[model samples]
Target: MNPEKAFKYDVLINAEDLCDREFEQQDFLKRAKAKKRTIVFAPRRYGKTSLIKNVVGNSFFNLSRNHLVLFFDLMDVQSMESIAKRLHHGITQALSRRFPVKTLLKNATDYLKGFSLQMDMDPVTGQPSLSMNVKGREVENEMTHLMAAIKTLSQKYPTLIILDEFHDITFVPEAEALFRGVLQELGESAVFILGSKRHLLTLMFQDARAPLFQYGDEIHLNPIALEDWLDYFRERMTPNKIIIGEEELKWILETLCDVPNAICEFGAWLLDNIPSGMTLSVGVIKQSLDLMVENKQSYAYMLQGYTEKELDLMTVIAKNKFTLEPHAESFLKLIRVSKSTVGKIVKKFMDRGLIEYELEKGYRLSDPLMGHYLATR
Candidate 1:
């Protein structure tokens, strides 16, 4: 954690916890009361989970009478039932553990037990588990049962389900149907705050023909304000506050595009390496950037979901360090992609928010890390 960094590992520092999150408090209250669903889409390492955790931590919402926030991050979960039951149990468990749910959800525990619900945790860690039939029809039934269970809880208590790494649902169409159904059925009584790496949900809804075709307030979690990042770093400085040259730090942020996670990771490296930790010079910052660049594969993994040509296009954009939105035509020549296929790939990535296109500006990486990875990978 290095304690004194703009941000740190395992820390949830978002707008909600900044002494006053009142600016967005109204929207939070409305979402809580209206019970709408939000799909949060951002590039990798953007603190999607941290922001939601912060939202739940904010006393204005989490402690309110009409709200129960359940956050489930299925980053590593590969199966569906494990997701189902964990979601099922997480809602009720969070209700009981985090809040005064006895009054909000009567019977509290027994009412849930009465549902005849059954679930188990992953064998290794004993954390709640979920799995689905690989090639059968069981997923539909599981989804049905899972939704039925979540809805049952909503009947008793106002519930806000925050699903992180939500794009994982794309792996199973059955899961998508189940989620779409949840959005359809839960309506204004329940709030869904979802987080995903890409804008898959946007495309799913944006395409009028898709079943899950509707969307409500779509919030893009931006980089943690740079000032906040620096202030936190100044406070967290350990041993002795390590003074990083402003220009060097600015260069790092400019290179990284002010991403909180990367800032924390880079800061950690610098903090641990400094001999006296009194002050950091431009060379020290450059050294950290070198390490981050050398090990670019770590960040590049996030884009592994994209195809090879897609990677090629990204590589060009990364090398050039262009913006997210650019015309498809320019990319065709740069990546040496075939004219026929370039249009399709560009359209596909653009629609997915993987890249953006501006009339005058040409195309580029959606974020700095993605850009850098494309350049190096």
Candidate 2:
């Protein structure tokens, strides 16, 4: 091995085989098979995207005469027309991987017909240029051609449409209702797997007046256990190729709060440093941690709806080892609010989905994954 170096490429850590999350995977797969449109809810960086990626790779469902999985991410998309265009493009990408678009979209209407409901992107500065205008107004009729296309395609291939950041679709105003309506009409013919961060989805469903209300099976993605992670790392480490000491491993896990993205960041950092056959150390880890923290401080400012007192309380919870629940003394002092007052604040936050609580105890941030930020600044 080379005598000395600053490590190699960067640490690259990931589940050995996509870590198929049991409850989530089984729930959605079953729903999809029953032709039930489903929504997967999870906060950012909690592995929603990763889970979808894993499902696609698993082939647990058949593509021939059963299910054809089509995945799309709306992270960069922004408008109504953009929705139709993006779905057209996403489905086309999935189908055309083997079939040609020219062959499938034989008619002008056929071009716009494949998209039942679309997640819009701003016409300008979109990730990919999509032409989605078909015929009719914003009403259900407007989606006829696109709906027809998806129905036709499913007859032959049985599409499993996986939409990422589906909650964002609501920002397009009228898009959510139309999409949900389409789901109702599709029935057992096709399946849609939609995922979003939080509140928006619940709000849509809670409001019985909305078309999307109680539309599909709601599945929550969960964090992987520490024990599973430890076992995984042990299997992947080979003394001659890469070495990860127990202390360094523990430090990495503790600092990141088991966040998938943070774990990935540590892995990437680790990969960049590992020499052909050398072990990692504390210094390498500290440097990488600083880099990640430095890059992430901006989000702290972005999460600015809270008051100073609230922020301080959040900090306390962030640093504390106590449970996230109600009537907890430590949490009360951390927020510096009286019992009832803290209850009000907690209720407000719960309504906004900024935090969550156990029915019997106290509250914590709505998303546990955001706990990663506490590790930083």
Candidate 3:
């Protein structure tokens, strides 16, 4: 294997580059085929985006050839107008990928009547790029039109609309109710997949009072099994003549809490820093982890946003690993906060993805690397 083609770690893993999620890929595709609306919940950096892209990418399920897969990320969307623009762009981009520029413009004109469409060539990829723009103060009406257009287009082409980080939609007033209404109107004409962080997504879909409650089948993406990771590492490393034993692999996985992105970062670090035919050692692993922590120095600044009490509580949680008894006398003494205050701060931390709770493990820092950083600092 070429050195350039060795183990790669990217923000977005390509379909073919995915490690192991065969079961999830199949399950997601199954739901899409049934036209069932689905909601996926996962921790940050747990490969939720990668799984969705891999399932829909041409090299995998090949849904793009026959189905119009419109993917939009609602992350940090502040207004209804911004959402309208994102929807328009996603629709046009998905159409362009499926149909030729000329045909897409001609066929989509009726469906996208209100929006101005422009065709441009991407300088880097030399591919046709479509841009959609609409101007108006009536953002809500524009959203309604977009949904109506989606319903009409779905009749011709089987459609799959993915809204990633969809919890951010809460920022815009009445966005959830609007979406629920549109979803009801579309019925089985389209399949929708909504993805978000576990904490926020759960509140949106599980709260009885929420408009989107029980709106879709829910799926949670868990960490890849250690056995699978070991096999994947061995296969990838053997080709490059790099040696890593199972014990060292397990240690790395445990250190990163089996987060796929973090593990891939470690692998990429090894491929770049270590020489071929050299066995991975504990010392080298420690260095890689330290380097990773150093690379994530920006994470520390996130602390500035919290209150002093919140910071103290977080520090306690990080140092202890997982606290089963957060309200215990000793825990409360450490944070110097009342029991009620501890509850509020813990809820806030959980809401922000700073901490997670397991039935057996209690509360722990969501990012284990952050735990190491907090411990040392």
Candidate 4:
């Protein structure tokens, strides 16, 4: 076993720490400053959270010190009421950070009259905490008030509200209709930043029959270039007196499909678990791969929720590196299921956010690590 080192590479990095997402960051800032409604998307664990946190939350475009940025993560939201509460809380949190407590309370109460706002002392910390409440029909009314408040703030501060995992909004019944109606009424004063799973976001924003169709400009966040990641890896490794050759860097990128988070995580493992002042070699790489296989057990556990047929279908997917047409004779013989049954299985996996399909790429596993693990296993 290699002796552990103290140095750690964070999987979640700030924009300054981020490697080569300049174009995506600039596009986002440009659309936001112009008050254009925009939707940004990428596959899960592709650093959507990191980008928004560092770029928007850090206010890269706030040159005048006049824009208020409110960020909300809808990943945990399951209902309209929860959305209202989160929005109300997110706005309050942003205000509390920028202004005095007394001023925050007064402004919140005045603008968000639909929600009762007050300041209370924390029992344990003896710190002042803002409390807000909206019940029953007031939830809807307050959601509208919240948008209006944001619009009002935008006139002075040019507010930008980023709702991460915005596609989750579709899970709540009639939530899309309510949001569309409210945003249309609210106008362009406040810019909306929506980040979500690419496929679901496309269905929500690009599908003609969807309520929010054509409502926002769409941008895709691509994986970082291998050259940029190579520099990042070498920079991180050299400071620890550890060296990684070009071939090793290329192997890591290819194995991880150039996804930023996975690469950083494995790199963190190499930095922290390997002995300090020791150069990384192919043996160390093998050890890392072994550790990765151990992590794949978690993916295996996830597979427990699936049926045997589904498991076999996943095997077929992994073996092929892409899903073959269900009706194709070779595919049908391999899965030993009817074409309609295979179609249903594929749809179910897609709905569960486990698969993606493209004409050029065919069907792909959403988690590249999972696909790699399953393929080798």
Candidate 5:
């Protein structure tokens, strides 16, 4: 493979080349084949999306080549209409993948009756785009119809529906109940894979009072193992004569917090900027890391979005790495905030995906690079 295309940092990793996740892939496939619902919980940049794509692309549950896979990104969803529109488009795109435009229109005409579906040529790509419009008071009805269409399609084909960033559904009132109703209705006709950040996703499924409590098997994604990273690094770099030792590779993983995307970014950076001899020394590696941190300066504006106390509390957490006790007297003194204030700030940042809590590590910045940047800057 071309070195330029070998490291995929900004996009989904190719199915064949995706590293690690062997256990996850097999577990997910087994559940999917058995038509079990799954909730995937992970921090951002942990390759949740790539993992799902790989499973579907490679296995397809050993089903027909035309099995349908629908992906809906529910990020920042604010209203019922937004949910309805996303579902409508996701169903349409999934069908398009299986059938030609004419067949899609002909078949969907019956499957999607009563919904105003349109097929138009995209101005930018000149490709056909299919969409459904949800109007005024009919938003709820449209959402119901969309879910029904999913059930109908699943009965005829092996189907997988993925809702990415599903935690954003909380923005819409009673959305959880709405989804629970749909899940109860669907049964084994389809497999639903819901992905979201760890903390919020856990609460949604584990809190008994929540509507989606115990709805599916929950899988929490952790960092890729160091041995797997070593193998992947050697395979990708050795081909291009890029010389990086195992120790240096392990340091890169630790420095980047074992986030697959960031590690790939580092690899891509090395490929683009390594010396002509293709040797990566400690000084060069450190310089590369420094440059990566410097490039994150744009994220400094996020600090401005918080209040003074929030910023101070974040700084304390970032610098200290993790705080076992945010309300402890010494920790509170460092941030110069009351326990109540710290509690509110921690919750706010956690919700915003800036902070995360580990059972052993307590509270820390969700993105370690952001922590490093905050500590230095």
Candidate 6:
């Protein structure tokens, strides 16, 4: 097998595996190690998860010996039970990493008061893991107990917990309140690192009445710049004897809106297609992009649910490529919709997660490629 095949240009879960975002990594490291609460948010696919993991991993190495790091991914959690299970899993994972299995097993009950812990060994790896259950019967009871457990654990050890895709908690009323209350109760001893999709995340922190309002310092993750992409690609391609020119690299970045995931995926595609000892060119880039669009028929399928006005507005959005004033006379005229109709359409788009609007930034489509699909298809 070719060793280069192991290289990934996909979703990165660890910081050590990523090539850029040095600024974000350092900022998070400093704040988190200081035990300051921080919230790291970005649009989907902007590599927020990888950044947090990198910072968390670094903290374990650099922070005071008494501190423990815990990561809970709330992406797949839907109900109180599931969230409890994930928290249980996260706490166990952190404990397993820090203390011996025998020690954790002996002390788990004392460390986590409200929840019961059962220790077992992995048959293959022979590593000990724990399962948690509340002393009570219902999920709410379990969650209440879990919160108690977290409170107890936080007081005992200085802990940092990263809640990835935390915005999903909005779906469950009880879970959101319980989690927030716990964080409030725990105070400075437990620092939370939250990750979420930008739209929902915005609502959580920006809405004054929300439980997570003013929860922590908000750090927005933006696109990795062109020069960073160039440096990264040049280094990755060097081992394969392939080189991409400055202009060629710029075109790719421009085409992909400088999104790191797209840039990495497109670069990998180029590596697979370009012959060794050859310089990649504009034509090759266009051809690869065309192939990618052709394969993404699902983008078209996604538009099937939108009204004609919504689709027209999307096309205009793609063409303008900036925050849009959909209510403006020119935009309404171009889309041929009335002012009242435009407001409804914008809200509809926002509700469906296809678009977003802010006073400062106007309106934006969530995915850049989705705009490309609308403009061309």
All candidates' TM-scores?
A: 0.71, 0.65, 0.87, 0.85, 0.90, 0.84
Task: Give the residue spans of candidate 6 off by over 4 A.
Answer: 1-7, 61-66, 121-126, 208-212, 297-320, 332-362
Give model 1's TM-score versus the native structure.
0.71
Each candidate's clash count: 15, 29, 0, 0, 0, 0
Q: Tens-digit lDDT track for model 5 on 315-361? A: 88878877889989999889787899788878878777778777676
| TM-score of candidate 6 relative to the true fold | 0.84
lDDT of 4: 0.71
In model 5, residue pairs whose N, Cα or C atoms come closer than 3 Å (at least 3 residues apart or on different chains), thus clashing, are none
Candidate 2 C-alpha lDDT tens digits along 241-345: 677677877777666554556565556565655575767687877776666555665557756867876666566665552255645786676566888876676
Candidate 1 segments whose C-alpha is farther than 4 A from its true place: 1-7, 10-30, 33-36, 57-67, 74-86, 92-137, 167-171, 188-190, 206-214, 277-283, 295-312, 323-329, 340-377
**Between candidates 1 and 5, the lDDT winner:** 5
Scored against the true structure, residue 360 in model 5 reaches a CA lDDT of 77
Ten contiguous residues minimizing lDDT sum, candidate 3: 54-63
In Å, residue 44's CA in model 3 sits off its true spot by 1.1
Off by over 4 Å in 3: 1-5, 57-65, 123-126, 189-192, 239-241, 281-284, 301-307, 324-328, 358-360
Q: What is the alpha-carbon lDDT for the whole of candidate 6?
A: 0.72
Model 3 TM-score, 2 decimals? 0.87
| Model 5 deviation from the true structure expressed as Cα RMSD, one decimal place | 2.5
Residue lDDT tens for model 6, 40-152: 76655667766776555556545666677777888856787789888878877777777776787788888677677777877988877777766778877777777777777
Across 96-123, the per-residue lDDT of candidate 1 in tens digits comes to 4544423524443443442333245558
lDDT of 3 at 12: 79
Off by over 4 Å in 2: 1-17, 20-34, 57-62, 65-67, 75-78, 105-144, 190-192, 206-213, 235-251, 273-292, 295-317, 320-376
lDDT of 4 by residue, 189-248 (tens): 444555535667778878899877888777677768878877777777776888888778
